[model samples]
Target chain A: MSGNILEVSGLTKTVGGGKKIVDGLSFDMKKGEILGLLGPNGAGKTTTIRMIVGLMSKTDGSVTINGRDLDEQGKACRANIGAIVENPTFYEYMSGYKNLKLWGRMAGGSVTEERISEVVSLVKLEDAIKDKVKKYSLGMKQRLGVAQAILHRPSLLILDEPTNGLDPKGIRELRDYLRELADEGISTLVSSHLLSEMQLMCDRVVIMEKGKVIDISDLSSLNAYGDKDQVAVSISVKKGQGEAAKTAVSVLEEVTVASHETENELLLDMGRDRIPELNRVLVKAGIDVFGIESKRTSLEEKFLQLTSGKADKEAN
Target chain B: MFALLHNEWSKLWNKKQPWIFIGILIVISIGTAFLYTAFDTLEGAGTEGDGENWEVTLELENEQYAQTIAESDDEWEREFAQDRIEENEALLAAGVDPNETNNAVFLNEMIYVGTAFITLFAVILASTIVSSEQDKGTLKHLFVRPYERWQFLVAKFITVILFAAVMLVTVTAVQYLMGTIMFGTGSFSTPVVEYGMGGVITTTVAEVFPQKIGLYFLNMLMFVVISFSISILFKSQTLAVGIGIFILFGTNILQGFAPLLQDYFWYPYVFLPHMTLQSYVVTDEFIPGVGLGFSLAVLAVYAVLFLGAATAFFQKRDLV
Candidate 1:
């Protein structure tokens, strides 16, 4: 058997007479890995998650979960998936414990009381589990949502914007829990517009734009310590020497001036081997360079660059 | 499937509306019993001769019905007076007090009032079952489970029926307790005379009461299906309930006009006039030329169509 838990290929969704909401999207999720579906607004991230969980119909393509085709073996395929699509909602009048029991029963099979308590404690909701959900804060409700999703120990747990309304501590707790679940070999697919959170939580990210996959990158590879062919270096010079430094860096043939960090700082994209040459050119132009450091591309920067580049290409 | 049904059952009992409805039913039923007891006592004190001699009361009531039957121009009025005369004569001969405050009589009255409220509550419950889940956005949690879409819909449909059954039993128990407490338990073997088109149909309270309850549920099933279909077709609980209640109360008005419309070929096929399943039990025919078999068959067809449409729509529509 392949180690992958979910394999989606050539997935397409068209709505309202041919407006393609999701177009030719394909990706795979491995066991014990957290795959982030990173996208801007209206990037079909939610649409893809909805289709994977079978909440929305896909116009074309096949979704196979743990080697079972979703179309032919839908019951078996969906049995392995637990999802919280968009925002998780429960019967507000019911206590959190009752809500969990209610959904646990709906999940089929006899869910023991121990399992219910286990999930409650796993989400750190033991104290608040007896309280009605209407009294729960957004963060507590989010924790309850995650607890319910993982109750059955589904092979693939899909969360769409699970951290949307969480406070910092709640987000951290969720991240820790997801990591712990991954340690036990449960795959998770989380979709989010929060790029930084995705950076901290996901192992690999599939970035999408305009109903299509733009890029897929390992989170470690996007970090500064990971291998990259080129790096953007930020040079800090004197406050008033910024304009002169820009002109000197622009005159260089190999390096591209990426952005100005501030009046005193200049950012440029070039190889590490040419940093000394660029420094010599800046010094020759009478610009005082105080400090030079290589800046790693953040997930946010990469996301903006990739999506904006696609938007530019489309416009062209 | 059992698990899903159990989950739905939990969701329903946890809500405030069902309990509130039960509370209201209990209050109204007990209050009505108290009022009936008080009125009967006062009327007995006011009429000295009639209270002592029911035979004299029956003779007077029979004479009045005979006068009405002779003077009435309307055919239905004459038939109604003639039936009342026969019913009163039978009660006089059997030594039964028509005005007695007994458990059987209270039960009969409660069922009459309870069935109306039960129908309203059943419609409200069925109309909101699916739509309320959609409104609260809990359907996503449910649909993601291993069950098929049709299974979810069927679970909800079965839950509504179970809810109706629960409500029926609750009403029966509450009314039974209150009736026994207020008025002594009357003889279940006592025969109550029902005025039929052919003549007086006599049956014991035990036999007739259950049949009325059965017919009540059957009538409720028709409304439940209609409201369930409306719930699936529309996401707004207000719209579903409003249309359901409108159809429910509107049918009374439609029945009034049914005689004029019965000449039309499609009159028997129309579901509203046929919803009066009680008419089949008490009278031979509610609508002219429409018997109990015909009404039941028409309602059965409507029930199937409503459920079929609901399941089909719910299966095909995207849960967005």
Candidate 2:
């Protein structure tokens, strides 16, 4: 069952100042899926989320949350959505517990004090929840913010830059908590410019740039390029014979070669499917081969390749 | 609505300014009464030096007493002189007249004048009632709730009204207490000024309680309407308060110098002039072209226009 909780089609917004902050953006999150919205700065991620939550009127297109039309039945539609926009502005003079309780009341029938307590525990803010929000550290405030969003048990949760200003440990904890939330069958859409964190946390990612969706892929697919088989061939020859092997491997059509003059080792980067052919070719070319191994790839390189590849393709 | 009322009541009661308003009312009412009574009592003292016309008449009577003592044959003149002296002494010894009390009038006047303080509080309290939430970026949280936008606007308006009522009641109570203590509780009544509205529309001061309450209610109502609109429009409490007070008092300041622009500016609604519960006490007959009712009607129209505008704009406003 493709249980899509939020389906936004052709969503666009032009602010009063005559700028198109959101342009033709469309995406969805399935039940039990955590979709990360990744983009660079000024990429309209916040604007898209705001439009989805009905905090903004779209200049064009429609957003349906849990199949309720946002414009025709705004309050009813928004009932199924919980969003933590920006800093999650709360009454600072109030305690975190009071703030959550008030938000719970605002969230209506689905929320209760017991649920508030549950959310606080979910965010690991049980100890500081009683303290005034103004006294909270940045990480604690963010955790409290998340607690407020989930207090109502909204079927769809949208968090804009949820892990911002958090330390690494806090970010990890937040990621773990979000995963646990998704495990309970809740749908989440988290936006961030940090691709690395997005790779680790999101079940899937919708890549946006310049107010438009450039790509949407599951985590496996987004990082698929990184995990592609690229066998690293490390070969050691007699001293002063490394250059000859590098020269010989350089002529191979299916492989790229690199050599360290002092180390007497040459590394051959070729696809696994092509590796056997290249090895046969290298043996035929009279290059001495010593060692061969594969190294783990990185999401950063994959993201760069995807974005840059798209840019190059567009240029063509 | 009940939850909204509870929140509003809590915020109002938690503040200190309401008590301060009561304190001002008590101090001014008592102080004015003591000063006015002292002035009246001192004025009743002897007709010494006999310079003014009334004092000259008393001096002339005293001279006649001296002449009768010199003649002495009838003693009737002497009796008359003794009677005159006793009458003047009695007049000098009498305290202020209880019937002609300006203390109540002055206390009521003080209440009218002190509305500026209330306006100041209204500005600060109601200005960012909604906008500040937007400014601090909290409005999204408010909007995502199940409540309709109109309910939020109504909640804010209700809160402002409650605060204003609390201030009015506390101040009036304190002033009433002070008036009783200092001016003596002999009578708490003003003589009914009978004025018929028309041939069949007969009304008196005693019968015009509705009109009086209506006028008080209207004055604060206008303040509420104006403050609510301006606060929503400006989105800054300080600016709303500053502008609201300015409009309330500034119009009066301009009206005071009406000789310069009275023709151009046809008397704007001065908040102080409309604050009195004694509408008849301060009524002015329309002189040829200028009508008091015309200005009041204009104010009434403005109040309606402000409320309509507030509802239209606030209801549609995106919380951001």
Candidate 3:
């Protein structure tokens, strides 16, 4: 049950003019894992997602979902996956309920009346389900989108930029729903440039840039990235003692000076267990430690450690 | 497959376009019935004898037509006189008077009228089905499901054909009822005039009804195939519908230019001139040499080509 749910190997999409919109890229998701494709706009995150879901053709590479090859067993492979690409669009003239029922019919009878009601309730769209989608708000549409994607009980769910237009509360609720789905052993591949939302939603993040995956880091627990078990500790000292603090902690083996925040402050990347030892060395150097705080592990910390590139892309 | 068709059918009726089209058809049908009544009365004006002595009047007209048929040197003029004489003889032999207004005559006149409108609506439906989904961004949802890309195309194609069939039948039904209500019920065995190989022909309304409807349906289907595939292959819905309308009305307009252009090798091969397939019910020859089978085969080949190109382009298109 814990094996890989989706494996995309060397997936590529070359558009007209012979330019590759999505270069050869590969990534995988374990069963029940929440994987995030983190990238700025124009990074080909959407293109890669489209190729996996069969919305677009791949110039090269293979995708296997639930042990079925996507190219060889397209229908069988799609049966196991549900998706929300960018904004969800339903028939504007139809009620939300009818829209779901239409999709239910397309799912080949796997979606029952009970299942429809259950999914509607899961997204808390019970009240608005009977209303036409043309009358729905953006937030309500997003909720219905989630309901539509998960209606068939697909083993794998893919959402591209699910947080594009959601409010803070709506995004939090979506995060909660996704985590709840993960608890039920359903895997999700969510793509977004909203690093902070991905921070709270995904169990792992695959950072992409310019149609290529640059890094894949585990974010389920604190700091499972470069230098395992390490944390970013910022030690603020007396104005003149910053240099002395630096010289004093130079003797430590596992600690690296991460970055300097101010003239009187220094940031250190060291093992969590070595925090006290490094603090003692600074005090032993006749430096008064004014504020010594260990920062919580986050994607922000990883972005700083991995690359100096822009971390958060606020794309629409 | 049932589910897919049901979904398509629901989508078509759920929108406002079909309702508006139906409403307009009803209004126009009623208007045409009244217009025809007015014209019928105007032509038979000012004389009670004109209404009562139609048999003597037709005999006199037939004698003149017979003289033209025997004396006219022009081949088309001779054919025209021959057509008129035979048409009057059929009515006289059937003992049906032309001055008598009846539902059968109304139906016989209007049966093929609504097909132009039906083809218009079908073209609109077929042109918009796929492209509208793409415009709304829901096409990717359709493609990502557990169905092949061509299944959606096939479903849409079938849906358009069904729509055309329904419209054709519905419009005819409405016309028949209006005719019955406006005029007196007439015999189905009333002689209907038609043009055939080298001469005019006459058959009963009951005999020609099915042939006219069936041939027109086949013609409209070819229209749907061309427009549906164009919309799928191209991104612009307007261009597809435009081409469809051009093919619809252009068939008649281009015929005025046919004599000047008929010498070209490509003229007979052009499917536009052959689109009026219902004419085949009256005559085997479309032009000098083209027959019903050859025209049908040409239309089928064009349909396959348009649909093939559309499916190929659609299957590979990146919906992003």
Candidate 4:
């Protein structure tokens, strides 16, 4: 209730007679926070989620949920967690309402009819709740999956690639619902390869590579790492002054010209405080400055750089 | 555990499989009764011209079997002739028509036919209980619940057993209705002769009918445990069912070969030799040294071993 809602330390999983699929991975999630697990193919994101949810056994280390150890007090720990590993599977032949009832009873709490109805509406599936799951669209199924997981209102919710087959609108709706859930104090751990979606959905992210935690940072702070004092700025100049503008920005002592958007516009890497200094320097050199704007690196770019082995250079 | 079992039961009841199986049993039950009635009517019509009473027919069959016993040099032939002669003598003295279509005969034949169908349905149920969840990828959902792995498994185990019981009761009820409507409840107190390992036994239809049904249920349990265990170990519904049905039918073939291998030390321990609980129910013995107690004990051991293995494997296995 006070500390982290979920904490995983030194978790390791080995398969095929000693092939370590997940090695020494550790992270934590605070209450009401949305944590994203990002990794490339075969980076063990699913394996880590599976181990945490007890779908797959861990070879070593421990998982503590709601201050209860998973190995020592599994039932107590698991009682606080609701998870859907990979694609959510359901009894497709049954109605979505029945599926919820089935899991609701198994969820080990007083799941009333009102609660089931509330969750059904929460996932926006009220119109289709009585329909067979086999008739549901992929996005509807994903929402139903979320409904099932949160039926008991567990302290921590884990979803592994919950948006695997969702369309754009469905993904947006899911992201919005997850944020709404987080605001209600349900800590969530989501594993997804969709960096853009993770950026929009997650509060903090743990980036993994080859079964190891490569990086963990706030979504806003990911671009701030290694460039804490510098900001990417783009300056627009008069139509034919692009070269002169680039030359003028290159000559500035505080700024490093990064690229040119056009013959008249130039991009620079400089401190936010020094942006005015460069603008003044360019204006004083008889340059026609149209506008200057600071640009931040996108999460997709940062993700590619980190996973492509440029993390060390970028972090430094 | 109760909640888990309740959930399992609900899921099973919600599916169309059990209902479909029930429908199949009903159709087969009514169909068998109608077919038997038709065949009985046809035979009675054809045999009326012979002018031979039921007693005269039995006497003639007994004389023929006695002559065969006297002339036959083969041991098995002599034994078969002697048993038939004794059966005829008993029927003749009891004034019971062997060809009569009565409620007792209906129930008895229904039990025999129903056991085969019930075994088939039970095998299908047990084999798919675990493996279908795995195949559908719904097992991970169950595993993530607060219940222990064995609780889910044991729930499924109990559900399959319950399903078999339900099927047995249903078949019996349908057969009873059909028999009452068609055969007028033909005196449940009437006597019937049953062949068993200890030779032959005579008992009232009321007593023997329930015992036969109970023995069939026990036989189903024996197969259910094995099939359920196979489902857990292999995680393949097809394999579990295939092997289950193979064992079900294969035991009959093995029974034929059993007499030849009766001298082997492991013959009694082999499951096929004891698959038929009818032998124990009738004569209280299946083989020379194997009695009711011994057969039930062996089956109990196999059941325990199967369930233990299923629990152990499911507990440790990763739900991939």
DockQ numbers for every candidate?
Answer: 0.78, 0.46, 0.76, 0.75
Please give each candidate's TM-score. 0.90, 0.75, 0.90, 0.92
Steric clash pairs (candidate 1): none
lDDT of 1: 0.84
What is the C-alpha lDDT profile of model 3 across B1-320, one tens digit per residue?
77888999999888999888888777777777888889878867733446668788778888988898889899999888877788778767766666676787787777766777888989999999999999999998988899988888888888888878778777887888888999988888877666565555567788887788888899999999989988888877999999999888889898879888888889988888888888887887867788898999899999989999999998878786
Q: What is the per-residue lDDT of model 4 for residues A1-316, given as tens digits with 9 covering 90 to 100?
A: 5489989999999999898889999998888999999877678999998888888889999998988889988877777888888888999989999999899988765799999999999999999999999999999999999999999988899999988889999999989888889999999999987777888899899998889998897886644545345777888889989998887777777678788767888888787777777877789889888898887766776777777754333322
CAPRI verdict on model 1? medium
| CA RMSD of all predictions | 3.5, 9.2, 3.6, 3.4
DockQ of 2: 0.46
Q: Can you write out model 3's per-residue Cα lDDT over A207-292, one digit (the tens) per residue?
A: 88778878898886753444346787899999977787888988999789987757799998888778878878887888988988
Model 4, position B217: C-alpha lDDT score:
81
| Candidate 2 positional error at B101, Å | 6.7
**Which ten-residue region of model 1 chain B has the weakest summed lDDT?**
B43-52
Candidates 1 and 3 compared: the better one by DockQ is: 1
In order of DockQ, best first, we have 1, 3, 4, 2
Order by TM-score, highest first: 4, 1, 3, 2
Ten contiguous residues minimizing lDDT sum, candidate 4 chain B: B43-52
lDDT of 1 by residue, B128-211 (tens): 989988988998888888888888788888988887887788778777787889888888777676655456667778878888
Cα lDDT over the full model 4? 0.85
